[model samples]
Target: MFFQTEFTHVIELFQLPFMQRALLGGILTGIMGGVLGSFTILRQLSFFCDALGHSALLGISLGYLLGLNPSLVLLPFAVIFALAVSYLLEHTRLWTDALLNIIYSSSLAIAIIILSFVGQYKGGLNNLLFGDILAVQQLDLVLSSLLLIVCTIYIGMTLRTQMLLTVDESLAIARGVSVSTQRTVFIVLLSLVVGISIKSIGVLLVSAFVVIPACAARLMSRTFTHYVLLSAGLGALSAVLGMVSSAWFNLPSGPSIVATQLAIFLTAMVIPRLRSVTHSPSTLPPQV
Candidate 1:
């Protein structure tokens, strides 16, 4: 009786219009994060994604100053930032970590300074910083759906080339892949994903949203295709579960989603060890 009542309550909660929007938004964000995150993990560009998220604040501030929607500015700003970083990595002698740190700190500082100049901005910066998924609206859903479709088509067509480039740039070049172009395109797409995701997952948790599910999938997958699919699946699962849990428990949606991903990661970490222990030769011998 208790279980039946609880299940009905869960269904009723999801039937709310805001909850429905939040769920759809969360799913789109999760799938996008997972799909792009696989490449970031393989290319060791996770920090680059984080830097992009931080740098987006500058764009938001500029948007407010110019009386434009922040989302309108964010994608272009992120693309420019990504291209600059890619160019620097290719031509400069500085280490990747140092360059990213410099950009991340400088951009964030500049954004704060700009915001101060904006003076009494009524925009909810907290939503940008920490996220408020429950605040998702119809336009957000429409934009997210379009972005997801575009990203999916791009990834589907370039998956093989991207995989080869990720594995070995020289080999990819030998096979006639344009290493520079592929990397640039990938960086731009990643920037777009990170930019869109900031609204739902927040700047603070975007990296975790993108990275954690891929990491968890890595532990469970034995092949590249499997890894990608499982990562996306896990991401979608976590988002749904997190949103439901948030609605039921009155928790912050972004943090709840991240917490769910963390739990999956820990479970992925432990399951293999548990399996090994359970199937060990010592245990088999004892049984014999």
Candidate 2:
């Protein structure tokens, strides 16, 4: 009865406008993260997402300095950062990991230096670092929905080529897939995902949405199609679970969401092990 009552209360919380927006926005962003996150995991570009998330801080700092909404500044800044990173990787000889590492470090420093002067005005530093999902705005949801639509279309058009390139670039090239072009296209879409989501999930935890779900999906997926759908499902599931738990416990939504994903990861890991044990030949004595 107590659990039922608490569940009722949690459902009631969603009647608030802010909660409505958070749930809608979180689900959209979660779907995008899961979709691209699978490709990112395959391409070994998790750190690239880290660099983009960190670079968002620079844009947010600039927004504070300029008296603009941080999301406005974040959009262009993240898109440019993604393009520049892609260009550098294609044009230079530096290892992808090393280039991202330098950007990650430098961007963090630059953001801190700028924020130190203007951070007092943009509703405090905590919001940028940890996020405030209940404070989600209407515009944030609109922009997130638009980006999700664009990403879906882009994937529908290029999914096969993207997979081919990731699996073996030489084979992709022989098959007439333009590696550089596909990378550029995907990076641009991914930057928008990070930009729009940062407002709700924060830069520190934004990458988690894109990473953890797809990772957990990898353990149980039997085919590529299964992997893609399962990853997105896991992402959306985590967002909804996290939102309810956050409303119930008054916890930070971003951490709550990521924690749910972590729990899923643990469950995915253990289930495979349990299956192996259960299906193994019996070792116990056969009692008459």
Candidate 3:
């Protein structure tokens, strides 16, 4: 009875316009986060996304300084930053983690300096820092959906090359994949996704959305196909459930969703150990 009541309440929550938009945005962000995060984890670029999140503050500050919509200013700044980072990553020897840290720290410092002058340009700054899914707008939903579609199309068109590059860059190069271009395109897309998602997921936790679900999916995947599908599915599932959970408990949506994803990741971490122990020869019943 309790379960039925809760389920009914969840269904009823969707009747509200805000809830509907939040769910749609969550699903779209989930798919993008999962797919991109799989690639990010494989490439060990968790710091990269996290750093991009930090850098967004500078962009947000700039938007405030200019008295414009934050996302409008944020997208261009993020793309420019991505372009620069991609160039340096391809051309220089600096570690990606180290470079990203330097960039984000510098950006945060600059953002602070600017914020001091802008004088709380908008109250929405706090929301950008920590995210607010319930407050997500229709534009955010549309942008995230478009991101999902673009990512899907790009991956679909270049699946083989992407896989080869991820698994073996040398082999991909030998197979005629343009590694540089592919990397740049992927980085740009990552930036755009990060920029657009900041309003909904916040800079502090958006990377969690990208990294955690993919890591959970990675735990038991048997094949590349399984890995990709599982990661995306887990991401979408976590996002949807997280939003529902947040609404039910009146929790902060960003943190609640991330916590849910973290829980799933922990569960994934334990599952393999349990499976191994259960399947051990010593555990088999002798009478069988």
Model 3 TM-score relative to the real fold: 0.93
Model 2 over residues 27-124: C-alpha lDDT tens digits? 99889999999898998888899889988999988888889977778899999989998888878898989989899889889888888887475456
Models sorted by TM-score, best on top:
2, 1, 3
Better of 1 and 3 by lDDT: 1
Model 1: residues with Cα > 4 Å off, grouped in runs: 1-6, 283-288
Indicate the TM-score of model 1: 0.94
Error of 3 at 85 (Å): 1.4
TM-score versus the correct structure, for each prediction: 0.94, 0.94, 0.93
lDDT value, candidate 1, whole model:
0.88
